[model samples]
Target: MKKIVSKKDIAHLDQRFRANFINSIEGFKALNLVGTIHSNGGTNLAPFNSIFHIGANPPLIGMVSRPDTVDRHTLENIRSTGQFTLNHVNETIYRKAHQSAARYDTNVSEFKAVGLNEQFINGFSAPFVQESKLKMGLELREIKTVELNGTYIIIGEIIHIEMATNKISEDGFVDIQQLGTITVAGLDAYYKTSLLERLPYAKPLM
Candidate 1:
């Protein structure tokens, strides 16, 4: 049986309860480690669950940055450098990836603090999580503010991709389940994935 929690109830709930409850209501979210480098050459790695593909034509991906009310190092660096990386969190590094969220001083590199390796290929400004099995290099396309909530939507165009060759299927679909990409619930819970049957494109009977 489902418990009914109305808007009124939600509004009256404890603050921390509301945070966890609201975030968890969405079921599962895609978790990735966003890597960036500050203008002073300080590197950062933070995990986020808000990444979504904006389009494939230009290979764009979008992610959300919470209100700038607090010090958001990732957002600041992306703006200054116009580059960042979206690296999928896998089973091996999920704990380290989660730990990267702890508020650290500006001079600290979460990549180093959390024991994850930082990788950079020529021409890409942002670092990549070398521990990640699947990673994408992105160039900033736009940053739009949400007038209602004060959050931000960052859109980026995928410029480069690196992954293990065997993870890709012959038809070109990247096998995420095989890659051990983890899905997150609420703030800290992580779950591994398994492949279900793939169905053909839906078509209506005439």
Candidate 2:
């Protein structure tokens, strides 16, 4: 028989253990490094897997941020300057991207500490990961606070996009498999992705 964990049992589990278990249960998540720059010019890079699309007409994306329980440089910088960049985690820079998750000091620049190059685009206040094959710049649109868990959900409008020409298909799909993008399971395990299959649009009576 397979093991089962009840809510009561899980409630009694160790804090970190419960976090790891719940995080991994969601399966593979897209790994991305969010880049931000403070007004003082300190840069921050943090890897987050919670980025999700909210709409296409406006090209909006939403990302979950843990409540201001700690000094989160990414969130603070985004609030200060209202801009940030999202960079896909590739196989070659997975290690460096993960390093950004560490709690670096407020004035510290993770790009400098982790050995990743920071790139700035015209008219943008945030920096992008130079080594990332796919990157996008965003301007903060709104912030929603989840009262239940004290989590913050920040929504941004896509302002700029950068990618290699060969990585995109004629139909507008980015071939992530060919891009060597990496996904994450739990908090530490990193993985490369492959296409399982591309299915046609579903029909009511297909």
Residue-pair clashes per prediction, in order, are 0, 0
lDDT of 2 by residue, 148-184 (tens): 9988899999989998655556677878767778899
Best by lDDT: 1
Q: Could you tell me the TM-score of candidate 1?
A: 0.95
TM-scores for all candidates: the values are 0.95, 0.95
C-alpha RMSD in Å of predicted model 2 compared with the true structure: 1.4
Model 1 worst lDDT window (10 residues)? 66-75
Error of 1 at 118 (Å): 0.6
Q: Model 2's lDDT to the true fold? A: 0.88
User: Mind sharing the TM-score for model 2?
Assistant: 0.95
Which 10-residue window in model 2 sums to the lowest lDDT?
66-75
Alpha carbon lDDT at 73, candidate 1:
89
Q: Please provide, for model 1 over 79-180, each residue's C-alpha lDDT reduced to its tens digit, 9 standing for 90 to 100.
A: 999999999999999999989999888888999999999999999989999989899999999999998988899999999999865666667788787777
List per-prediction Cα lDDT, in the order shown.
0.89, 0.88
